[model samples]
Target: MGKEFRNQLMKVQKQFPQIIKEVRGKGLLNAVELNSKALSPISAYDVCLKLKDRGILAKPTHDTIIRLTPPLSMSSEDLQEAPKALHALLEHDLPEMKKQKPETVSGTVPNVCDRCGRNLYG
Candidate 1:
């Protein structure tokens, strides 16, 4: 990962404690999560847009996670462009996240044994 991006992300983490729960990833493939399930995807999207405006394009994943996947071969100068963008998103866009209610999806994912005809749970 680029040093500049890491530096910027660290900056955001320092500034926003409640909003940014955790950050994980290697190289330029990183994710920042929100503290609550209710504030994930929307906040992530806003972060992406802020990065876009600063010419550091990124995307969101798992609804509540912001993915910072820049090219693996990014330069120091190129990497430095993420801090202000991220800060802007944290400051201005995070408060608009809607409440996330609980729901369930039906249909079990069958886990079959390689040599058995039965599903793992049954």
Candidate 2:
């Protein structure tokens, strides 16, 4: 898993040098940030879809960051393919995400869980 993630991360770094500011983390947990609003959740969603299409699953957190948490034992090829997929997604989707108005962007999680909309203040 570590090797796979590393390979993919390196590929992404190489492919999108202008946008990728830095990548951090280890094992199956990793994150890469872009230079601009590309880090936004809306853009991450499109990137996530691109990852999904490549058989690598990922998601965004905080609506301004994308995180990669593949199985701890994914193969090298799978890892290598992730960035390629994400690149394609970013090229097409990032612009659209940037075009959206700030008000149009939705929150990542609801204020409360569906089953417990109330706060847990006891």
Candidate 3:
């Protein structure tokens, strides 16, 4: 099941070489490394946010890698949807996201808390 899921994800990577740097993993634990240069102002967290909006929950690691660990009980059919959603996002939404400007921060631009968006440096 893990191999099948990784293969499906590899297909998505092939479809978007500019965005996906590599796809690697063992068992149900996998990571998608995105081209940081290609993503620019958009981080992996931003991509995860989009994925979340599409009903997928993924985590960002090292700012450019997305960690995917589906539950063990997930059926192969349901698991297949992950790659499809990723493909759709890269194909349709990414282009639009690229066009948008990064959010501008006023003043000193302190680092904010990820979960609550509070000013971490304050």
Q: Which stretches of candidate 3 lie over 4 Å from their true place?
A: 103-122
User: Which should have the higher TM-score, number 2 or number 3?
Assistant: 3
Give the winner by TM-score: 1 or 2. 1
Off by over 4 Å in 1: 1-4, 37-41, 95-122
- Candidate 3 C-alpha lDDT tens digits along 70-122: 99999989999889889988888887887795744545544885666878777
**Model 3, position 20: C-alpha lDDT score:** 99
lDDT of every model, 2 decimals? 0.64, 0.64, 0.87
**Tens digits of lDDT, candidate 1, 24-73:** 77767777776644454454655566567767777766346777787767
Sum up the clashes in candidate 2. Answer: 1
Model 3 reaches what TM-score against the true structure?
0.83
TM-score ranking of the models: 3, 1, 2
Q: What is the C-alpha RMSD of each candidate to the true structure, in Å?
A: 7.8, 5.1, 3.4
| TM-score against truth, every candidate | 0.61, 0.60, 0.83
